[model samples]
Target: MPTVLVTGASRGLGREFVRQYAAAGWQVIACARNPDTMGDLASDSTVLQKLDLLDPATITALANALVDRPIDILLNNAGTMGSQSFAKHGLNVQRFGQSDYADWEHLFQVNVLGPMRMAEAFVEHVAASKRKVIVTLTSMVGSMATNAAGGLYAYRSSKAAANAIMKSMSIDLAARGIIATPIHPGWAKTEMGGPNAPLNPVDAVAGVRRVIDGLTPEKAGRFWQFDGTEMPW
Candidate 1:
């Protein structure tokens, strides 16, 4: 069976990814800030691990523990939209003149730096696998061409940086047969997406899985939506 290492598997899309992949018989290394919070994700094929994207030590430790394993997919799915609750405050907290440098720094740590660190630590595991792939869950708000409203400054910039990192990884790791790309999961009704959002976690994750399933060398380094449409970077 193919092995997939997924970060942020405690809840939301990450949890859904764990469910889907485990159901399909993949060996899942599910990483969360608190492994105990991954409720019911445990199975014979699923290994729950503790991970905190903000801490480099935890990342390195996990990589070392799984050193001998060839991970077919390295799913960098952990991210943040700062401390603001989009469900209650909407985009007001992240709007112009309301920029919080601390929050922005936290967002960059999780959204941008975390994936870069993961890629660096796990590159060998991915390259050794039969179906080598690295996927980062970015957002449409990150797209320069798609930005019209322009309110989520921190979140948007972090994701954009993540896209750039994945692009570089795609180019640098091509010779190793690793396909690196960033994918947008759409406005799903998660805590970050708010209750008003149209897409549900289940369907959104399913779409993302299909996109990952279809990834190829020619398709690496591009921005893709959950529905399989390429987004402008």
Candidate 2:
């Protein structure tokens, strides 16, 4: 069976990805910052371990733990938004006024650096699988062309950075035959997405999975929307 690993598998899109992938008969390794609260997910025997992407030691340990195992798909799904840091006051309403650079740094830490680190640690394991694919969850907001109504400075920039890194990784890891792509999961209903989100999380996952299913090595390093359309960086 194909084995897939999803980071931030505790809740929201990450949790949904784990459920869907595991339900499809794939060996799902659901990872989260807190595995203690993830007892429900642990019911799946295939779930490998919980991981904290922000912690380098934990990352290395997780990689070491999976040393001989094959990981087919690696889903870099964990992320944080600046709103979670500065509270509700600082929005586009103020237009960058009172914006916290610290929040930006934290956002980049999770959204950009976290994915890059995870991929580096797990690339070898992914290569050993039948299907070697690394799917980094990016956002359409990362598209420079699509950022006409700019507001989410930190979140948008971090995701954009992730797209760039994932592209570079595709090129760098090509010799190992791994296919990597930065996929834009359209805004969906979730805690991160909020109630105003247009698409339901389940539908969004379905669309993204379809795009993932059809990807080829030629499609590697590309920025694609949930509908499988090429997105301009």
> Best candidate per lDDT, number?
1
State the local distance difference test value for candidate 1.
0.93
Q: What clash count goes with each model?
A: 0, 0
Encode model 2's per-residue lDDT on 1-233: one tens digit a residue. 88889988888898888878877888888888888887787655456476887787888999999898998899898887855522233235214665588877878888998998999899889999888999999988788987787677777788889999999999998889999999988878777777777898788888888988998899999999888899999
**lDDT value, residue 123 of candidate 1:** 97
- In terms of lDDT, model 2 sits at 0.84
lDDT of each: 0.93, 0.84
Candidate 1: Cα lDDT at 39: 62
